[model samples]
Target: MAPHLGDWRGRYRGAAIAVVRPASTAEVAAVVRACAEAGVPMVPQGGNTSLCGAATPGPDALSVVISLSRLKRVRAIDAANNTITAEAGCVLQTLQEAAAQAGRLFPLSLAAEGSCQIGGNLSTNAGGVQVLRYGNARELTLGLEVVLASGEVWDGLRGLRKDNTGYDLKHLFIGAEGTLGIITAAVLKLFPLPRATATAWLAIASPAVAVRLLGDLQASFGSLLTACELISDLALGLVRKHLPGSSPTLSPSSWHLLIEVSGGDDAQAGQQALEAFLAEALENGTVNDAVLAQSNEQARRLWALRENIGEAQKIEGLSIKHDVSVPISRIAEFVERADRQLAQAFPDIRIVTFGHIGDGNLHYNQSKAEAGDNAAFIAAQSAVNRIVHDLVHQLGGSISAEHGIGQLKREELLRYKSPVEIEMMRAIKRTFDPQGLMNPGKLL
Candidate 1:
């Protein structure tokens, strides 16, 4: 209970009377039933790696924490079906490895994949770099096995890809953040393993150029463009400073794009295509400078530059973080306008910006430029949030893109969502958990 009381960010501390580890869905249902019958609240926890405190119990000590770690297992893999059934406690990286072992690809990826659980990934509908090619968790999931509030296990672990049944019940629980039920197991969609891959690091002029390059690459490469990330110069500097051996492959510039293309066919042709496209981009001044990875090791190093942004920022200092998105067409406008607006509002603030721009998501963070106590500056979170979120809203964007509306963004959800939409969500919550025992104080 003590260990399960805190979230990954240490931003939330909770209290639970007991932390129960269930080995199977039946055991989970039994525990849930007993807790509900005893009038005790419950919080379903996965890897405890949630950034928004979704897995952490509330401050009240009345709830019981149900840890799904003991249920880890890869139930089945149907390569022909292109789906894998995994238990709730399966670590995301292990699933990815299992898919690779079976010569397939499970593409729900992020920094926390090493520690985050499959259930949490589905629960949050997490988005990642490959979202440009492979959709988010919700799209990749084919079926779900969940335990309802009353301990009834809804065995939805079907691998059929074209089951146009009545209502899609899996969706209600996938992104519900445990507000509806406990996600016990899931059947996730997988793709053919990429046999050939090419990666590049490019220095670009601005966000507008990055957007133009993205459109051009999409037009040229189509589905081969698996990932396209945008990084600011300051974000790269933080990586170089905090992560040893993290050197830029390309010359320093104001902004950078870490682009990748993958194909299951010939490696040489894929490499040639990517290089030819880059040559054209460079010739047209669309790319100021670029470096292409000649080997797998170099590709990994190039990816580390983009993948290490979160950890780099963490080492730098406490910062206000926003996982947001706008329409792809409006991404450049959003960045330019948000930068100007935030610069005017908070002078001398270090803005660390980077994310999967291929899909219009951005991990925009801010902190005091100088390394000192930012407690006072952190106190202005609401102001900072209002400025950023308001702009996102006006541009028809989402405040929480990959991360769900856990306890961290509940208030923001209320502010951004319409009354009718909020009411619909509340109605669904009531229909699913009438007793309100499932993950209280989350999402809603």
Candidate 2:
């Protein structure tokens, strides 16, 4: 119960009347019905790996938490249709392994895939390294099975490529963060397993250079360019400092790029294509220095540097973290201006920046240089957020990019979104959950 009441970051702790684990969709429906009849608020939880505290119940209200861990199952796999029907509690890694076994690919990947649930992925519309080629969770999902506010189960699990239906209702629940309903199951899209993959670590001059290189890679490889991640030198240094051996062995530069190209033909062809591109870029000074992985183990090592940024930061100490996204064209400007402004506002603040640059998302985080001053720096998070989020808003960006607006960004959403937009969201919230008993104090 205690574990279920807290979030992954430990930033939020909540109180729940009881945490109930329902083994099946019918059991989940029964729990919902009971909660509804008793006029008790309900919080639907999965994996509990949400960075934004979306799944945790409010400390003020003694609500009933419905943990979906017991509902883990791989319902079916339609290889011909390129879809997988999985229960809510199924771990993301399990689905990926299941897909691999069937000669298919489930590409919704993140650092937390080992522990995060598919239902939570759908709820947050998670974006990961592969999003450059495979889009986010919302685009990958075809259908969902949800338990309505009244305990009625809505099994809209249809695996169709194209449907000219009036309204795509599944989307309403996808990124709603359980404010609308509980996602009991989902029908997710799959791709053909790639025969070969090429991973590389590049030393870049700046974010602008990384963005330009990204355009070049996309033009050359097209859809084969699977991932493009940008990491500041400071960020990579943290990984090297805290998580030794995971950092890539490459010439250090101000900025680094981790790129992967996969699919089409055999391993030799993929490797050749990527090598050719890198050689040309290196000759032209587009890439300062680069290291192309020769084996699968090497590729995984390169990815570990990018994946371990968050954990490394955690190991370092408490920091102000912001998951933001601007247009591909404005990302460089956003980073530059925000960095300068934040530096001026808070002296001695160590900024560790990195993220999926291919999709315009950047995890811009800040902390004090000295561990003793971190507590004081964290107390000024609001000022730091204002500097970062204001720039994001001015550049026509999102403050909460891949991570959905849970309790953490609920207020920020209102500040950035228009009145009409906020009103419309509230209207939908009222429609799906009139009593505001469904994951209250989240999203809208």
Candidate 3:
């Protein structure tokens, strides 16, 4: 019960009357039915790896937490159809392994893939580094099995890519953050595993340059380009300081781009092509320095630097984190303006920016120097959020990108969302959970 009560980031601590582990979809339905009969609120939790407190119950509510960790099973794999049916509690890495064992690829990946369950990934519509090629959790999903707020099982888990049969009800629950219903099982799309891959880390002048390099890579490689991540000097510095020896030292630059290209069935061909592109970019002065991974082990080491940014930040200290997204064309402008404004408001502010720049999502975070009191720096989260989120909104972007509107950003959701949009979301909530028992005080 205690382990299931808190979020991964240590930002949210909650209380629940009892935590019940349901072994199957039927057991989940029974748990919901029993809770519904007593009119008790319920929180459907998976992995408990939510950074935004999405899985944590409210502190005051005596709700029943329905843990889906027990429902871990890979139901079936249709290699011919390129789909895998898995239970909600199936760990994301496990699903990826299962897909690989079936001679397929499940590309929905993130840093928390080792522990985070597929249920939470679907609920949050998670976007990872591979979103540039594979798309997010929502895009990869074909069907879902949900236990509605009324304790009724809705088995819509069909592995059909072309189901134009009435409304696409599966989408209503995906990215809904479990406010509508509990996802029990899902049929996810898969792809042919890439035999050859090319990864490189490039030191660029700034975000503008990174964006430009992204364009050039897209023009040259097209669908072969799988991931393009942008990282700031400060963000890398933290990783180097806290997690020493984890990443190789590279040329010092204001910004860095970690890009990968995968295709074909031959490794040398892919590497040669990427190497040629990098050499040309270097000669043209677009790239300051570049390191193309010589082998698969080296590529994994390079990716570790990008994936460990969040953990490194935690070790550094408390920071105000903002997961925002803008159009790919406007990323440079958003960063330039936001950095200036935040620096002016809080002097000597250490802003750490990094994320999937290919998809326009940036994890912009801020903390103070070693001499400064981080407690005081964290106290200014509201002012920091205002400067960052307002610019994101002004640039026609989203306040909450991959991280959903959990307890952390409920107010920001209202602040940025239009009245009409808010009303529509509320209407959907009312329609799905009329009794308001499904994960209350969440996205709505």
What is the TM-score of each predicted model, taking all chains together? Answer: 0.98, 0.99, 0.99
Off by over 4 Å in 3: none
Encode model 2's per-residue lDDT on 1-444: one tens digit a residue: 899999988899999889999999999999999988988999999999998999999997569999999889999999999999999999999999999999999999999999999999999999998999999999999999999999999989999879887899999998999999999999999999999999999999999999999999999999999999999999989988988995566676999999999998699989998999999999999999999999999999999989999889888888889999999999899988988998898887788999999999999999997877889889998998999999899898999988998999988998999999999999999999988889989998
Q: State the lDDT at 156 in candidate 1.
A: 92
lDDT of 1 by residue, 162-265 (tens): 88879989999988998899999999999999999999999998889999999999999999899999999999999999997856567668999999999858
Each model's lDDT comes to 0.91, 0.92, 0.93
For model 1 the TM-score comes to: 0.98
Q: How does candidate 3 score on lDDT?
A: 0.93
lDDT (10s digit) by residue, model 3, range 1-444: 789888988888889999999899999999999998999999999988887899999998589999999999999999999999999999999999999998899999899999999999999999999999989989999999999999999999999989888999999999999999999999999999999999999999999999999999999999999999999988888888898865655677999999999989989999999999999999999999999999899999899999989999988878899999999999999999999999899888889999999999999998888636678889878988999999999999999889898899999899999999999999999999999999998887
Candidate 1 error regions (>4 Å): 371-373
Model 2 TM-score is 0.99
